[model samples]
Target: MTATTIPTKTIYAGTGRRKASIARVRLIPGSGKLTINGLPGESYLQYSPNYIRITYGPLHTLGLDKEYDILVNAQGGGLTGQADAIRLGVARALCNVNPEHRGALKAEGHLTRDSRVKERRKYGLRKARKAPQFSKR
Candidate 1:
């Protein structure tokens, strides 16, 4: 008699960054569940609908929101930046699962990493470009 073995589902990985935030994302074949830094996505994001929407934008765009589970580890920056970073990470992971998703994700701008960050303060500036109070005696 011959033995048959079943293949396990594959896991896809991707990294994304926005401002000072970084996210490591994983996509696996499962229900539409999301976890961030060992916590449920909603709880971690403070139950904000906008954060949830931003984090799931890529999957929604490709109509795969309920097809796979997402696992994310994010750090640094604020909530918004972390959400955007997770979005890009998810988009990249989708592309990894199927290269054909690239065009769709790209068209939706999910594949683009936001590069905007806070400007550094100069020596003579109060903050970034803000000047100190002028004293004209």
Candidate 2:
């Protein structure tokens, strides 16, 4: 008997981190729609460009100027941070889904992991950047 082969599906997985927040994502090709546990997107839609666009920036990349419907579960971030984290997670997943899209997303710096974070204040410093009230004698 001849050997039969089945095509493998491309799947992408990525994690998003910002400050103390993080979003884990698994992406598959489908009608874009975002569903976040208790909070329905209807209320959060205004917060995010789109379910999948959160990370892909689908509108910017595809240039369709529209958002896709997708399901998402995010935690650890505020409305804005969660949105950003979701975007990161989704974008990373997109890279795994298709290698070709990497260039497009990377060009926009979406794929790059955001390393910037709040700096720790040093001893005798009121803040990370601000020196304790300087008083000249």
Cα RMSD, each candidate: 5.3, 6.2
lDDT for each residue of candidate 1 in 1-137, tens digit (9 for 90 to 100): 11122378677888899999999998888899999999999999999999999999999998998998999999999999999999999998888888999999999899988889999989988999999999999
lDDT tens digits by residue: candidate 2, 63-85: 52333433467777466666677
lDDT of candidates 1 onward, in order: 0.91, 0.61
Residue-level lDDT for 116 in candidate 2: 70
The candidate that achieves the highest lDDT relative to the unseen native structure: 1
How far in Å is the alpha carbon of 122 misplaced in model 2?
1.8
Best-performing candidate as measured by TM-score: 1
| Candidate 1 stretches greater than 4 Å from native | 1-7
Assess every candidate by TM-score.
Answer: 0.93, 0.67
Clashing pairs in model 1, backbone N/Cα/C closer than 3 A:
none
